[model samples]
Each structure stands twice: as structure tokens, then as C-alpha cells.
Target: MINFTLDQWYGWINAFLWPFARLLAMFSVAPVFGESTAPSIPKVGLAAVIAMVVAPTLPPFPALATSSYEGLLVLAQQVFIGMALGFVIRICFSAVQTAGDFVGLQMGLSLATLYDPSTHSNTEVLARLFNILAMLVFLVFNGHLLMLDVLIRSFTALPIGHASLNPAAWMGLAELGGKIFSSGLLLALPLIAALLTLNISLGILNRAAPQLSAFSVGFPIMLISGVLLLTVVLPHTPSYLNEFYQEMLGHMARIADTFAAPRGGAN
Candidate 1:
């Protein structure tokens, strides 16, 4: 049997535990990995596997005993940092879904909804479709790998338990809330403009001919127009989404920077 002191055992445990906490928090909130339909065993197992892989590169944890108050604080900090990172990614996907919802509404498909098992909520059909497209692009282009890269770089950028999340960082996260709307609106604008014009023309026609059934005529036009408009938009999503993905991750890096240790500072 190998001789190991209590401190040695604790150090070994610390090496794994802290990274695992952060990875678990990340997967709990990160896109794709966080979906409710994702099996818990695999998710946790993946986090554990990654934590093990990254463990050797981690800066040394504080010398304080694992059971100490400081250790608990460090654990919490890891969770917060992981969550902050994951939330940024989640926002990007949400924006895509929002854009789809806007298009669906314009197409008079608002009533066509589906149960989203991932969120335990009802989402418009087109919104789900857009989300699936966005997700596929994310996977095809290895965007999720980029997210993992960010998480790994974060250990260097933010370090383990080196700094506390401040009010400003939290505020920065809140700002992403508005970003969802702006980006979503940008994606949906062309379709919206087209549909709005169609609706207005239909309205004038209805006024000119009272016998014209605007409901019957308007619905078909909007349906066909929406489908055509989406076809135009869908092909371009990958490029636009790529730009948005980079922008979102860039913000996350900056957030990590806020917590970075001063150059050459003692661990």
C-alpha cells in the first residue's frame, strides 16, 4: 500500500474536486449540455472526465484545509464563474430562438406551438426549428468545442478561487439580456418588414373591397411569404451566427479577464 499523509490525500482530492465543481456548473447551464433531456449520468461523467484531463494544468489550490471556510468559498466561486460563462452561451441560442418566434408571429404561425422538453415549456414551431438549426450549426462547426476552449482558458484567465465575482460582473451579465432582443430583432427584421408590407397591402385591399375576405386572402399570402422569406434567411444563418458566437464568447473572455491574477502575482 502507498503511504499517504492526510494532507497528501486532501491535496489529491482538492485537485479533482474544484475543477469538477466548475465543470459541473458549466454543463448544468451550458447549451446542449444543459438541456433537461440530456442524461444526467453522461453529463456528470463528462464533466468528471474533463476535470481529470484539465486537473494537471490547474494552478495550485490554496493551502487551506478542504473542510475550512475558505475552501467552501472557493467552491462557490468556481460555480459562479462556470455559471457566468455558461449563461453567455445560453443567451446566444436564445437569441436564435427569439428570431424564429418573430418570424413565426409574422407568418401567423404563433398558434403553432410545440412542447419543448428541453425547457419544459411551449415554444412556437418555427422557433424550435430555428433553434435546431442553430444547434446543428453549432455542432457542425465545433462551436461547443470553442465553448470548452473558453472554459479551459478561463482557468488561466480567472484561475481557481483567486477572485470573487463582483457586482459589476453580475451587471455585465444583465446587459446580455438586452443583447438577446437586439440580435434577435436584427435576424428577424427582413422578414418582419416583408410581412408588415404584405399586411398593409391586404388591409387596403380589404377597405377597397368590403366583400374580400382578408382572413382568407391574407393568411395564404403571409404563409407563402413567410416560407419564402425564411428560406432566404436560413442559408445566411451560419455566417451571422458565427459572428454572433464570436462576439458572445469575446464578452465571456473579458469577464474572465476581470478575475485574472495580476501578471506574476503569487498563486
Candidate 2:
């Protein structure tokens, strides 16, 4: 004999559906988990599994029919929250790629690009290389686990169906977006300065010895120097990436708090 009332069914559904919506939205944008080449079925399944695990811990859902306007609005809020959080982490990878682009341009490898399935666009060769390294660094530091933990904590900070997201949160996200350039430039600065000095020296040599072809001599020298510099630079990069991930995790928490706070209130 099986007896299940409609209210009980709604309770079960509410416990799972909203959380599932948020998790699915997050996986749609998060790095590695969200890669375009990855099959969609796994993402959906993983979201479902996580939603099942998280549902029991969630606070009771507000009294609203799933098909009602208010319920839909809440659902949209959850999706937005998930996507925004995932995007915040995605920015970390973008910063690394940006640094690579700067270095590659300096090294005359700007034209050497490949199709990046994750972005669905062509990216500079060095950018792709840096992205791969960043992915590895992220895994080494258990960033994926941290990301999941943040998502879980977000329920406590933002909750389900408390839908008034602060405008300042969006503003903050926009501001954080600007870090792609600033952080990237900082990362590439040492190499950029060295390469600029090398180019200057090459220019002076060319001026003093007009017989030496700049194209033949300067190009090879620059290429070799860039390779050597990159080898030296990369060993130090994991440390920088570790710090960057820690900072980004802090930002994620702050953003969740911002998302939960009342408009114009201190977060």
C-alpha cells in the first residue's frame, strides 16, 4: 500500500526542483564541468545527484505553487545566482589566459591560435597553454571541491526564494570583471619588461650594424629568448595561481553575501 498526499509530493518536488535548477545553471557555466565538448547528460545527472544531497538540508520552501508567477521569479533568481557564481570563478581562468596572450604577443606567437572548445572560439596558442596549466593548478588545489562547498554555503547566505538580489552585487561583478586586464598585466609584466629590453637592444644592434638583417637575426633571438623566459616563468606560476584561487574564493563568499543583502545595506 502506497499513500502520498499532494502536499507531501509538493514538498518533495520543491525540495529537489529549485536546487536542481540552480545546480544545472551553475554547471552550464562553470569551468571544466561546463566545457562544451563534455556531454550534457553527465552534467544533468551530477546536478540531480547534488540536488538530492542538498535538498534535505535546505530550509523549507515558501508557500507558492511551482507554476505560479512568484515561484517562477524565485526560480529565475536561483539560476542567476548560480550562473553569476560560476562566472566569477571563470574569470580566474580568463585572467590567466589574458596573461598568456600578452606574453604570446610579445613573443610573436599571437597568430598561432587553436580552437578552444570551452569558449567555442579560437584562442591564442599561449592562451590555450596557460588555460590548460591553470586547469591543472586548479585541480591540484582542489578548487572543484571548494567551488562545490561555496555553492552549498550559498544556500545559507542567499537561500531559496528570497529573491531581491542587491543591485550592488551586479555592480560588483562588473568591477571584478575588470581584473582580467589588471591581473593579466601584472602577471605578464616581468616578461614584458625583459622582452622590451631585449627588443631595444636588438634595435640598437641593428642600428650599429646595418649589415645584420633584423628579420634574420632579431626574430630568432627574440623567439629563443621568449622560450627561455617562459621556461623560467612557468615554475613560479603555480604559486601565483594558488594565491589567485584563494583570493577568488574570498570574492565568491563576498559576492554571495552581497547577493543576499538588502539593497543599500552593508554586506
Question: CA RMSD for every model?
Answer: 3.0, 1.2
**In candidate 2, which residue pairs get closer than 3 Å at backbone N, Cα or C atoms, i.e. clash?**
none
Candidate 1, 95-210: lDDT as tens digits: 98999999999899999999999889999999999899988988887889999999998988777868555556666788888878899999889889999999999999999998
Candidate 1 clashes between residue pairs 3 or more apart in a chain or in different chains = none
N/CA/C clash count, model 2: 0
Candidate 2, residues 120-216: lDDT per residue as tens digits?
A: 8999998999999999999999998999899899999888988688989888989999989988888889899999999999899889999988778
TM-score of each model, paired residue for residue: 0.94, 0.96
Off by over 4 Å in 1: 261-267
Q: Each prediction's Cα lDDT score?
A: 0.87, 0.89
Q: After TM-score superposition, what is the CA distance of residue 63 in candidate 2 from its true location, in Å?
A: 1.9
Best by lDDT: 2
